[model samples]
Target: MSAEVRELVRTYLPEFPIQYCKSLVTDTTQFMSIDYGHVIELGDVHYMVYKNEAERRFGLEDPKYWVKRCHELETGKRKILKLEFFETFPVQVGKFRVECYRSPDKESRILDIVRGDSRFMQGITIKDAAGRNVRVLEIVNGRRLDLTVDRIDVEHDVYFREHLPGLLRRYLEAVRAIGMLHRHGERHGDIRRDHLYVEHGTGNLCWIDFDYTFHSYEHPFGLDLFGLGNILVFLVGKANITVQSLEGMGLAERLEGRLSSDDLSIVIPNRIVNLRKIYPYVPEALNRVLMHFSNSAEVFYTTTDELLADLEPCVEALESEYGRKPE
Candidate 1:
């Protein structure tokens, strides 16, 4: 068990503690039937499983234990249980190729790195009975960032005027937290708008889903940077303003500027990275920050610090344009 788990993480998760992997010994395969009143132990901790909406509606034939909500009997607290899953995907950006994987071990390591940081979702890692790692995370009380952004009812100009700056600041906080991951020699691995949770009470932007893993000959944090760029576009446009997203709204003549192949993402070209052409009033500096990830971008962000550096001035510019003092 020790040898097998070590080989798995050492290959898939870089800089991970192999001995830690060796200690965890059981896969949560039996957890599928965990219904209401079921009591299970993970490491030294025990949890009483309750019926989530999916289980209540569908009657417990669920296979995915990656997102199970549980009530900790010992601590008498609610937490989420994530079982180990093995997934690998390939992503291409220009000439660079990246292989992304879902590694629970890596996420466990990151849980240690960001244990107390409220800017991120909280979680604890422990080994299950069959040498598998399980992540018991806080039940984040928040809405998905994408959904929260989607619920905003405003035109592009109004959103830009009233909302974008604040959203950008919060996103900068998240990007900086990703920098913390980099500082610890890890990446967010999966960075989607949905992975972000906007806390209900505090309005703090919390990051979830740190189980993504990839190592490349190109820049290590390159894909993370790419994901950051995608989120930036989402914030700037108030949603993911793709050509398809904007299709019914106008013809080519309705846009303020012409679209070129360069204005799109090199990997996913349909996403219009250059927001200035459509919004017209989007700050040029902010648009250039977005373009850093576009097909036309001569160079990409080498480090999170670089990305943060580029955006700081854009924050100031945005505040000035909105006639508000920069925070």
Candidate 2:
């Protein structure tokens, strides 16, 4: 990552201990990496420093200070991330009372023992100064889902355009993982394409960024749904209105001067037409899911289970259509 990228990440996470340091031989911008010195450990869990501008925006310094901030927040008070403070650190930052932090090691343990989906991340852990630990996940290799490849393309050796069906299947598997989180009453706060890692050889989708997951609340599942739609749109080569575009359009013009959440939802639709128009090959069942996801007006699927149920039939139908079998 470059200084600009580090700044961008810092904008979201102000306390991220790593700073934009030296350039690498690789053709990428300089960005922060773990300082290692700031790490702290507690009860078998490791934490890494994390901070963002939202801490000030929401006046949530006290909330962010707690070892387990999610558990401490009252569900009735916060509806997932309707407010700004509960934004970037999407999933559980610490073992908060309201939420449970999934260890990167746990996922790694499964990957190490399991023979399938070998593309998942291996064992890695990092601790931070605030004792706010998180599973260090690899950033997505290509373009961020919300931006067109041309706009925010990341040059990487791994590309999977040639295997469309394979790509879709991998995506479905990754959704199943998200479904697991949903089953546990948690919603992945960020589900964009850039958050998903593609195993170099297998071309499988690996879900990353469990930082801002919403847990056990009557919160709208819209964020996850919207993110899923964004991923699908990107997989097929389309752009959704991203933060970059929002910045470019001038927030006032984009929002028509309505800065409220109600107005913000309209921004993406205004810029990106729809994913369906971009990929005709997208199955009808999947399309229905996308439709529900893209809907800004209604709360369609209350949980990932509901969405997965709707998708099950589609997966089966596709498998049967070409005598495909799960590998």
TM-score for each predicted model, relative to the true structure: 0.83, 0.46
lDDT of each residue in 1-327, candidate 1, tens digit only: 245445444554435444433223245666555555444567656654554423211134544555577666556678888877787889887788899888988999998999999888888887777777878889789988887887888887887887778788888899999998998899998888877889998767999888888988568888888888888888888866677666576745576367788898876878888888887787788889999988999988988899999998998788777865321
Tell me how far the alpha carbon of residue 97 in candidate 2 is from the true structure, in angstroms, after superposition: 22
Q: Which regions of candidate 1 deviate over 4 angstroms?
A: 1-27, 30-37, 51-63, 251-253, 325-327
Question: Which digits, one per residue and each the tens of the lDDT, describe model 2 over residues 107-210?
Answer: 43333332243333332334333433333333234332223233434321112223333455666777777666556545565566656665544445666544
Best by lDDT: 1
